[model samples]
Target: MSSWNSLWKWGSVALLAYVIVRGFSTPLQPGLVESSPSRLAPGKHALTLQAVGQPFAEPDAESADFSLILRSGKELVRTDITAITPHSVEADVIIPEAVPSPAMDAFLFTPEAGTLFLGNAFFVEDAAVGPLPADLRAEAPTEVAPDLGFSFPYQPTIVESIRNLLWHVPMWFAMFFVMGIGFVASLAQLRTGLVKWDLRAEAAVRTGLVFGILGLATGSLWARFTWGAWWVSDPQLNGALVTVLLYSGYRVLRAALGEDERVGRIAAVYNVFAFVMLVILLMVLPRYTESLHPGKDGNPGFNSYDLDNSLRAVFYPAVIGWGALCYWMYTLRLRMNRVEHHLLTR
Candidate 1:
């Protein structure tokens, strides 16, 4: 156990360093973000599609190397690529007078980027709701083996915000770990009425609160960019904040009552109550109520599709790194508490 303890501090430093370097540096996969002149009519109109992700083109790129096709229902509209760049492509497409669907989806097939598709890109105006004309059909490019280098997945709403998974998720996990320690230490303090146990419990709670606050900050940042709001009315999100506030009261309670056996016992009891409230608010309420937070009801989460092996390679290490750091912080706080206790007693 002592050897493991000695190694974990070094482990925390090494793993956390790796997560910081890899998480921020990895590039994102190529994806289509916006289309210029989204509203179109039945005529030869020029269209430009804007892309945001890893560069999808080479310096020596040609129009022939790319294929731009527009879809309205089951029909595909032919388009001629007039120009291509690393970030965008310009195309000329003729929308037939009659089309099955008003909303058109665009598909850009490139040799380097493979394929980039944007749904509801263009809405047709002054066009009859009928089958697309036979003359508008176009063949898509054949699949080619393009070497898209190591990159993160490009989600429509969460393009770059996906990187927050490392900081936001692991910090929450670390908070849970630290709070669990506090809960168990509080139980031990209540049973034995030991000063050392009380010190440990207080340190754990103090360290846990730091992790919780970080979780809230990182989550807020993610919501701001991806959901377009810093704070929103969601069951799980509010539950998380309420739980953190409940834990915050523990520190406030300790500060109000100074050092004493009776006060320590009272604080331990309050600690137990706070931990229970944490579970109920964060775990129980979320299970029954509707939530807009990801991985909850009415919302989708980042699963294997979003968290590919490349992410797992770094994410797992991040969880371990953050958790170990939390433990190390708790130990430092506990030792400081012990020293202060000894000095006061002497």
Candidate 2:
């Protein structure tokens, strides 16, 4: 038992170490990060687009083979590449008097890199005409084979911050995993009237709270970079905050009922209720309403495209490793509670 426990503990540490090193070090695939003058006017316009991650155009690659396309509904309007750099490109796009759609999505077909996409990149407004005539529209781009390499998908808004998915998301998952254990333990305490179950429940809540707080902090940092705010009014974000606050009340309830013989039973009941609210607020409510947060109503999550096989390789280990570490903390706290109880009775 001792040998197996040691193996599990160290295995978690090693897996977390691997996740940290690989998660941070991996490069993102090439994609457009920003474009100057997001709104384009009718007629010929000079545009510059900045790129993040790997180089889109190869050093030896010719400009003739590369193409920039703007999708206005079904019509593909081609752009003339004026100049190309490793990290940025300048182009001359001739916007028709009118387009099929006002919002244009950009796609860069590169020889070295795959087709990079930026949805709603440039908005066409106040054009001289309505939709472009079919005869005036450009040809669709030729298909180019993607450069198959191990890298995270480059998201337009998320970009390098996509790496946070490995840390922020898994922390919440691990917290929920441990907190579920506490909820079950609390139920057992209420049924059996056992102090041991109460201790286990308390330890689990304390350990789970640590990860919960970390999840919020990491999520806040991620939001600051991507959403330009430390916090948002989004339902999912608020739900997470409320869930943490509710669990925190569990500890306060235990402290308030000190030395009472029924303290364990009362706190156990509170914890059971708290876990139910956790599911209702964090899981159920977020799905029903519209949210800026991904995986919610109308918004396709990172899992749809961003969480590829390369990310999963590091991500799965992170969840397991963090979960193991959380359980280890619970066990330590449970032993401490047992020791304290023995001392008080003596």
Candidate 3:
């Protein structure tokens, strides 16, 4: 039983090591991130496109092996590749005199990295809406899905910051796990008025705060990368901040009422209240309001769209490993609390 009990410690250490190594080490699928001269007129012009993530072309890739196409409503306007590199492409594009729509989408066909695309990349202002001329049309090359090895999915805004899902989300999960323990221990303290139960609640809260702070820090970093702000005024984000603050009050309440005869009972009741508020702030309130978080009413979730198998392989392990580490910390704090209480009472 002792060996079995110790197994999770090693397991969590190993799993966290795997998550860190795999999550940061993986690259993203190659994609076109930006375009030059977004506003174009109906005429021949030079166009340049910038790319990110994995390399889009080989070191010695030929211009003939690349193709650039534009979609204007129903018409496909093919362009000529003037120059190409591993990271960018230059094209001499002929804007059709008449296209079905003014908004154009660009598709770059690489010899190996499949079809890279950007929606509404160009807008033609002085163009008429109609069928594209035959001279501007060309059949696009077949998509060659390159074996990109193991990599994270490429999101338009998220890009490299997508890796934070492994850290920010798992830290919150770990906080919730240990805080749930504090909730149960609080209930037990109230039911039996036991000193042990009070100690357990205090320890759980103390440990949970560590993960809660980590969650907030990591979440802020991801927000800075994706949202261009360190903090946003969204419902989900505000709720998370409030929840962390409330948990912090649990620690303050215990410290202020230090050594009182009613400290255990009073602290347990406060913990119960704080836990209830945590549920509302982080879970219930976000669902009823407009939230920027995925799976909320307005936003599309990542899991259904872009969170692929590569992400799942590391994400699940990250959740389990972080939860185990949180619990281990809680148990250590609980033991230390019991030792201190015994010494003080003697």
RMSD of each: 2.2, 2.6, 2.1
Which pairs clash in model 2? none
Tens digits of per-residue lDDT for model 2, 239-346: 999889998999889899989999899999999999999998888898889888877784535545544788889888988988888888888999998999889879
Q: What value of lDDT does candidate 1 attain over all alpha carbons?
A: 0.86
- C-alpha TM-score for every candidate: 0.93, 0.90, 0.94
Which numbered prediction scores highest in TM-score against the true structure? 3
Residue 65 of model 2 has an lDDT of 70
Task: Look at candidate 2 and tell me the lDDT of residue 95.
Answer: 79
Off by over 4 Å in 3: 59-65, 298-302
Clashing residue pairs in candidate 3, if any? none
Question: What are the per-residue Cα lDDT tens digits for candidate 3 across 258-317?
Answer: 888899999999999999988888878887898777767744354552458888999999
Better of 1 and 2 by lDDT: 1
Question: Residue-wise lDDT of candidate 1 within 1-346, one digit each (tens)?
Answer: 9998889899999999999999899988788999989899888899999888887666354347788999889878889888877788899988888899999999888787677789999999999999877777887678666567767777888888788988999999999999999999999999999988889999999999999999999999999998899999887788889878988888788878865448788889999999998888777777678866767553335555445777888889999999999999999999999999899989
